[model samples]
Target: MGLFGSRGRRRDIPNNPALLAAAAENPGGSVAEIDPAYIDDPNGYVPQEAIRGSWLVDSGGKLTGEYEENPRHGVPQDDFSRLTDPDHWLGWLGDDPAAAVRKGIEESLRAQVADAVVEWVKILDAPRFLTGGRRHTEDEQVMLVTRAGLAAAFALSVRSTQHGRSTLLGVFSWVAAHLSEPQGRKDRTWFDLGVGLDWAGERLGERIYELDGTGGTVER
Candidate 1:
């Protein structure tokens, strides 16, 4: 039996392993035939080099390409950066961007989620925001923000994923809990989350995180 907190991810990213490999770097790499290593262990390795349309990933999860002091590339080479570009939205959603706009989530909400993803990346990159000015490696930032970003994604999933109805209460509750964090407090775009917490308070008779009164939340 699995121990407490010893669990699998509700969802694994880069649904397509081949997509994570920068096949172009390998001369003959193509979507039809990606690196054999990725095929064998989709979650075990990643693109060794930066590719035009590839993501940086390893056994643990998705990661961004090398962090830059002055990144000038117009195209994003990693999952985190891709979040900011709507053009990549379709690829992120398995070549079906429209599908991402689902039952309880509208295009606007989807935009917000994407924005949050970008913001989450910045928060992760800037470790000093939480630790009072301490420079950290990109890996450290990824470790810190991956789960939180995924957790925030849960709120979006509550509206978009097939498990929305089943996970509605749980997902919103989880989101609320995260919204109480220092980073969450600093993020003002999550007004939708306030609406969600209000619903929880009105219906569930319980609430863990409350809206910040300083206009960071939209309580109705």
Candidate 2:
């Protein structure tokens, strides 16, 4: 008799014999296809070289030509340097080129988030928080502070995702809970607890380990 319940019954789990054979032959074979553009010149500066493998994908469903882990030519390096350089293209655009470039960057960032913020706010139902408190209904200050905090959290999550550490779901949950209270004043202790739960969920989702006959190992 089977210890779990089944007795003298064939296992229902599907086993791919071909895949098993392939794995046995070539243990390092990857199931996912690596795009050539990303594999070639990940640095972008060295465009002549063959692209290397990358984890970043673009809107077109192609792997980004730029590297994700540690891009050789990236915003913090080349782009920022150019923006700050005296003889750079942006330097020629204005008298106070540095300030102008900074302003332009801010504007661009604001524009990028404008639509996203609107959509997010719509989904959040900001008006619901105004019901109980006179501070929330009469004075716009409470609402403004709440909106700003939520926006800051959203921006932080987006920035974190660029580095492959996305906390959007956590931030969203915290913001939602915060917005549920009257006068838009979130209970920090409660919010922190909620954030912890969200973090646990994230960790659980990323877990790849499974138990086999020998021991526990990473799945795929």
Error of 2 at 148 (Å): 36
lDDT of 2 by residue, 61-150 (tens): 332222222223221111223223323222122476334433433344345454221111011111111111123566656532221011
Candidate 2 lDDT trough over 10 residues, lowest sum: 121-130
Give each model's whole-structure lDDT: 0.26, 0.25
**Which regions of candidate 1 are displaced past 4 Å?**
1-31, 41-77, 86-220
Runs of candidate 2 exceeding 4 Å displacement: 1-78, 83-96, 115-220
- What does the lDDT read for residue 204 in candidate 2? 29
Residue pairs that clash (backbone atoms under 3 angstroms), model 2: 39-51, 39-52, 40-50, 40-51, 40-52, 41-51
Model 1: lDDT equals 0.26
